[model samples]
Target: MNEQEFLASYDPRAYPAVAVTVDVVALTIREGALHLLLIRRGEPPFAGHWALPGGFVRPDEDLITGARRELAEETGLGGERLHRIHLEQLGSYGDPDRDPRMRIVSVAHLAFAPDLPDAAAGSDADEAGWLPVTALPGRQLAFDHARVIDDGVERARSKLEYTPLATRFLAPEFTITELRAVYETVWGQPLHAGNFHRKVLSVPGFVESTGASTERGGARGGPRAKLYRAGDARLLHPALLRPAREEAVR
Candidate 1:
């Protein structure tokens, strides 16, 4: 068949390509607090609103590559350094009208960084900063982004209890105290220090000692602690579950 004939006979209705987009829930720590990256929309439908940093996936790129591209484009930093940013597929969101433009299937990713660079290099992100997740903005987020962020947070919280993902939020050779802080930050609760320490060590493959110690004690008043690194195990044999809140009497 000739090119013109093939073009005339093509039926998009019979073979539609679902548009794939990538959304990143980039999180970081700032001033001893857990924060999320928020971008201010510059265009319409929900212009001037806040949302997660992301964009449509390119045909030549993988889902993770696309997510990293979006992050780099909006953050202006690149290299294998970004490749180390612990990117994982959170879930897929494909509601018919989730996006006003067209049918867009987004594969959202969750990432944790010790720190983030500056604002978007040259995008419509009027502003980009780490906002305390506990105090997410009340403004309606653009394009169902609020739902995406919620899912990412839950994924982080659950992953930390059984997975070694918490290491992504820490520096190399960190102390147990620092690792526990990551868990407490995401879980939004206080963990018993002694119990937490014991439990973490008991979980084989969770961490390995480096035979090193922090140069100094905690900011407060404690002896210098030892350092450890993530181990070979990807999972915690005995996962840590957070304490459930008690119900109030009617």
Candidate 2:
């Protein structure tokens, strides 16, 4: 072996770099309820515990690619369906002792979808599924996943008023009523229909009409509603905020 070749065979552990991984907080509106995607850890440290879908990053993969790959592994969907997915980094979780195995850093991502099927573990996951956000299991999470999920939820809730993100939870063409429900579900508050309608339409670029209408009205008596799709604006001006409650004075 030549000197050049011998030097390249050094131990990787001698100069170890932190391992990076990507986790996903896949949120969806299911059964008029908000849900999150989670996987059951199969390995030790946190074995059998439910956590967010995630995996270590490969040498050549980018952060977003790793997230989509993890999502596809947890759930059997990919490509444009995944590319069209609205994904953004929620934050990073790297509390020294978060991972029991080794020093690992995780980039948490938040994705909004109209609907999704149950996830079955693939790649490094043991099992995956959609769980109602309100009823997250009590089992201990793998890493700092519980905290990561909390951040993702708050990001979703806060972004609703000033961004067009809420629309990501709806189909391409949806009625104003359908859009309002998305807000109500995420905020967990009931909004006046008249006020909601006026505010939503007033925000330019929040939505634009497709010049189409739903033939079938709501479950009960209601007029046919017009169909609209997402507009050009990424942020909403004059954001539609919910009313604040006043504290009772003694």
Candidate 3:
């Protein structure tokens, strides 16, 4: 058959109708703790519950594009701010009964960045703001969002071990101490300061000295720590595995 004949014969209704949505798990460090952007739903099927910023995928846009759009609309992030976020697809979830109204396959995305501005609620949301992850257990999240948030946090934690993406959670120039804080915050544990500093410097291409130091001395009035910027290496030659994970594996 020709192209037109095949198109005419295709039956979209031959299978059960399914919807595709995009949810963003945007993470950042705020006040020395991990925070996530959440919006309170203003519509049905999970109305009035705090959830990740997301919504139905429009007909014309692609998956990643749709995810960005949802964040733009639901969280009121501008185009430039949205572009600064490091967004990547985490996975897709499509359990038969995941969504009460119908079958919905959510293409979940994970984003990380340096602390962002406060979120503003858009039309679909009653409220929006950054909530510390430690408080997630207290809030009633909608639409399997609790699970999604967990998965996204895990992804960020794991990536810190091997990828230099952790730098994305900081300014262009930062101190090793500041960088280590990012790992410590996301991993939910304190990393040894001396050990972390030595390992970071030893890692080839993990960071490069900027020939400068911080303006102020250490907290106790010690000498200023040297500054460094992200290096060229894409992967950490020797991954900085989580210490707890190491003990668990042993």
Best TM-score among the predictions, by candidate number: 3
Decide which is better by lDDT, 2 or 3: 3
Question: Candidate 1: what lDDT?
Answer: 0.84
Lowest summed-lDDT stretch of 10 residues in model 1?
Answer: 241-250
lDDT of 2: 0.86
- lDDT of each residue in 1-250, candidate 1, tens digit only: 9999999998998965579999999888777778888888877767888888888888799999999998887777799888878888989999989988778899999988887776663466677766789788665688889899989988888888778888888887888988889888888888889988999999999899999888888789689899999899988888776655212211
Model 1 misses residue 100 by how many Å? 1.6
Cα lDDT listed for each candidate: 0.84, 0.86, 0.90
Which one wins on lDDT? 3
Q: Tell me how far the alpha carbon of residue 62 in candidate 1 is from the true structure, in angstroms, after superposition.
A: 2.1
Better of 2 and 3 by TM-score: 3
RMSD (Cα, Å) of model 1: 3.9
Model 3, C-alpha of 123: deviation from truth (Å): 0.7
What total of clashing residue pairs does each candidate reach? Answer: 0, 0, 0
Task: Name the regions of candidate 2 deviating beyond 4 angstroms.
Answer: 1-16, 245-250
lDDT at position 165, candidate 1:
86
Instruction: Write the candidate numbers in order of decreasing lDDT.
Output: 3, 2, 1
- Residues 1-250, candidate 3: write the lDDT tens digits: 9999999999999988999999999998999999999998899878989999888898999999998887777555776878988899998988888789999999999989886878889887889999999999999999888899999999999999998988999999999999999999999999999999999888999999999999999999999989999999899988888998767877
